[model samples]
Target: MSLCATVPDWQSPDLEVFSFFLKFCWILRMPMPTLQTGLPPGPKGSLIGGNLAQVGARRVDFFLEVARTYGPIASFRIGRWRLFLVSDPELIQQVLVTDARSYIKHFGARTFKPVLGNGLVTSEGDFWLAQRRLLQPAFLKAKVVSYAPIMAELTEAMLAKWPEGQSVDVAFEFSALTSAIALKTLFGLDDHGDRVQIDQSLRLTFELLTRRLDALFQLPLWLPTPANIRLNRAIANVNAVIDSFIAQKKAEPPGNDLLSTMIAAQHEDGGRMSARQLRDEAMTLYLAGHETTALTLTWSWYLLSQNPDAEAKLCEEWKRVLGGRAARAEDLGSLPYTSAVINEAMRLYPPVYVIGREAAADLELGGYRVKKGYTVLMSQWVNHRDPKYFPEPERFLPERWLGGLAGRLPKFAYYPFGGGQRLCIGVHFALMEAAIVLATVGQKFRFTVDPGAIIDIMPQITLPPKYGMPTTLMRR
Candidate 1:
């Protein structure tokens, strides 16, 4: 059986623990010696596979273990691939900002290119820079805030359907709301006719892509395999849905929506994006735009459900600030506690929890030599829980963020949206959307998470609730 199949699923830890222990036994045979290699400390792995097997299906936990056991700068191997986990804030700054030009996204990110194409997330070099410049104007604070009415309108629509005193999957609920918002904001579509097909196809494609990334040896896409066949079909379905939207958008006069902005955006030389470029950027925006905010709201509600005091405080703030009206863009500044709750929740369950880059040239990080091709991983999962910066790191204390803690924290210390030249372009839009959605929903209703629901982390490309957050809708 495959090592992946050995672990029943994320829900059951017994087999996963046993599987990890079995692989971990290989490390016991090796000794920890510096050997003048100048490499940082990490767990030894089997001679053939390195730490790959040991990291099976528990990468988030494994990364936490590596950081804790090996210190700020840690090294390990997976097959011939070398990876470094940088936990120190200063070193993280150097990698992400100061010397960012010396690196590109890591191999794992490239694995999604088949689906994501040469979009901003996967693109590199001059082309990526040009595209970023074009998209920057649309996501600026002024432009993002203009969409607040649409966000509030859609959120209220969702709240209307949320049955009070009924059990619902909060994950699915937030996902649907964010999907509607993304559809309206991205493509100027309110019908959401293609959403089900698009969501199903994207989910399948992501699952298969993850499996391919985790496999010891990646098979070529051309070669026919059951997984590959399904992946191809899923990709085809997603592209079909996207193409239909692009077609629809092209048929209409330009609007203020993101797709229209991309279509109409011109370069200094009077050049607009090509059809392929538009599709790629649209695909990137369509996926990246909504998933993070949805997860943010999903995890926020989950955290609030667990911490009633925080939830109560949030409700109190909304009551006082908005006077029972839905949140508007102008209300953002007045809603500091609302922002803190969202910030704190993101700090704990960051949507894009881990990010990595590959060294394009040999360089020094934290006084250690990093060879070209070495992948450097920065995980919000590990860093956010660091005891030094966030005292009582495990606690859900929104109050911690109340007193200018964000201003006081290190630049990289609380980076849920990431850092540096490649910081998420949707930062302003996402923050505004989450704040609007949170305030709009909190005043009228609260959630009590199902007592028996098994909550865990999926830890795929994004950090999602493993089994879905089932909760009872409590009308306030």
Candidate 2:
């Protein structure tokens, strides 16, 4: 079928009273309805869009100061939109878990529909409920346990390729490593060559997608400008790759592949995801699964590199547990310290730094009142480091976790996988994967950050290490 056929006649909507109800896929013409009141003050920037002008400069510092001053919820008007910045874990719990249905993702997610289609991350109401159910089984503990061997197998392969005493970008390496693992285990393969083309395309697509998603308030993606054109092309390349995979999967018998599980998933009403929905969901997993894990590993490696005592403890634990052998899924039960190390690193530099939601109705949170249509922002960056929960928050101390701090802390105080229902579906899988990969990599090698390397912060879809962590790997 032609691409034109999938696009609906949007003009028909303007004629109907139900124009607002139209799926955003083909209704890009209407002026977006503006949001008004949210909460109280922060750094008001340009008169046109408060704080939007400074979005490019030291956003980490800007957001930190906002959290410090606002104490949880703040309101700001950017462009034609009003936003409510939320930093309180209790309110975040209310919005994302308990009262989740009251809110919908911001319209910013509409741009992802072109790139991702309508998978779990983009679907709303029943569609989202149905999609999440169908894909849930494949990530169950037993099923995930089956993938641990794959993770260990690949970690060895990746480490072998690393050169001794040579400085390398551990961030990029972990990304590539996890990307390969996602392909193999998700698709029931031991090797992931077939997915390499799409895998590489993801970094490109995501970079563009992040920029476009961040600047959604400025203009639409259809503009004939250099950046927009490049982004569209990136989106198209990714769409084509995913579309091809879906098409190929259709011709084959139902297999153990994650895609097959999603394809065969049937809702209570007997509905299954459309190909586009599956495409989007698959892309979501591809993006969320790979990038976040990769970044976590990168930062974990960075922390281990910086703290020799901690790194020595990690190596000791690995050697004692595995003894020059490979790590397995069950072995993680005895490796709580390793898990704690990963936890501590993620606390300092989380993969999804800032999470957001849009208010479905007026709500009160953390001494502020938010109106409907206001943007609600939450940061793992601010919350995890809020000294109230984590003393000496800047210090990377893994022992705090193993020392019963996790129990002593309040609910949602350190939600690395996020909290409530929208919490990362793959939390278990990610933990297992990280434990196995960390143990495997730690057993074979150690990393040290190259001196004089400037560590900057880049707040894209995820807070990637801005300058990137280039470190030297010494073979153990």
Candidate 3:
């Protein structure tokens, strides 16, 4: 089937009628139509660019405001595209699970294709399914648990350098630690391979991606604008790093690391991913696997710093279970409070705050008729803070999760890792890593964020501290 065939034909006479209707409304200053017209109520955006300028830099806050001011299903526009933000849990379920195949990754997600390529995060249809199948084994609970020792080892290595009284930027420290762990566990690189280069390139690339997402107009990447040239160079640097990892892995015998697993994995028909396929999947996993977990840990530390009672409770749990030893897979089950702390951190500051999908065909959603090519956005930042499901939603209450609360809540209400088949593949890996690192570090060191640190969210692809989390290291 042709891609163009699936897109709505705006050239049809219906657009002329819509234009006439808008002119009529402008002349009389009448209110826009509502659900009776098959469109949900939304904020009134500017005529030329719709809500593009209103969204501006604080998009996460804007999404929350929109969901709160309007109902669960609200309509808005960004340039020529019609967008809907779905905040209702049941409605979210319908889009992500019941009718999953009717939607594809939206333009916001597609912005990373220059770096992520057609890996699971950006790919669609049968190819994404096949790639997911081949990669599933590497992230299963059994396989993921086996990587705990490596996580603990890398974390301990990082902690070794942190003297008790020294100050550290917790964000940068966690990012470097996780990047090293990712290089080892994902690509079979025993050392930090291209860590500095990879970090610089990723920063530049993601900065451009965020800019492109907010821009009312954008040039194709093929054009040689200054931003495009920088983006290309940044991408080339990352590709070089991935290529080097692949070359190094090829020379050595296969190991238990994920890249090796992907290399050896075969489909039911004995098909395998080509070198390019491997690069795409590796890039996706490398970015997805590390940064989100890093933010999880970084934010966990920041939250624990502010709430001493929660920090003390977490530390006490670690003291009881770990007893001055490094955390292992066996120790995780006994550390319920540790898990709670991580969960609460993600609730307040979800790394991947929003999930978006564009309708691949006309469909009914939340009692409204959504046309093909319309975009639907569901934000964890909004749903996780619903007062009905979570009383005092803004408070950092790890105890809220202590007594089967997770099981009691609506499925989509607290999905920091998202929901349904498209849920992050690294859910288990990320949870386990955050728990182990939190336990191992909390047992030895605690961070005290400055009282006036100017900590705020950057609202990039992942929610990171705007000023970076600077804290004094206090030994336990």
* TM-score of each model, paired residue for residue: 0.91, 0.87, 0.91
User: What stretches of model 3 exceed 4 Å from their correct place?
Assistant: 1-37, 266-271
Model 3 residue pairs with clashes:
none
Tens-digit per-residue lDDT, 286-359, candidate 1? 88889899999999998888888888788888888998899999999999999999999998999998999999
lDDT of each: 0.89, 0.77, 0.89
* Candidate 2 wrongly placed segments (more than 4 Å): 1-38, 189-200, 213-217, 268-272
Per residue, candidate 2 scores C-alpha lDDT tens digits across 1-476 of 99999876767755464554444524776555545433486767677666766655665666778888866776666666776667777777877887788788776565566666676666678767766777788789888999887888888888878899999988878877887788677754344454566655666666677666556254667788887787777777778876776777777788997977877877777888777677788788877777888888888888877789998888888889899788998899899889899899899988887777777887766666766887787778888879888899999999998878888876777877776666678998888888888888888888778889987768766778877888888888
* Candidate 2 global Cα RMSD: 12.2
Error of 3 at 61 (Å): 1.2
Better of 1 and 2 by TM-score: 1
- Mark the 10 consecutive residues where model 1 has the least summed lDDT: 26-35
Q: Which candidate do you rate higher for lDDT, 2 or 3?
A: 3
lDDT of 3 by residue, 1-476 (tens): 99988877788798789879989998999987663667899988889889998777588888988999998999999998899999999999999999999999999888888899999899999989988887888889998888899999999998999978877888988889888888887787966648878987998889888888788888999999999999999999999999888888988998878898888888788888888889999999988989999999999998888899988887777777788889999888898998898899999999999999999999999889999999999999999989999899999999999999999988899999888898899898999999988888888898988667889998878898888998999888
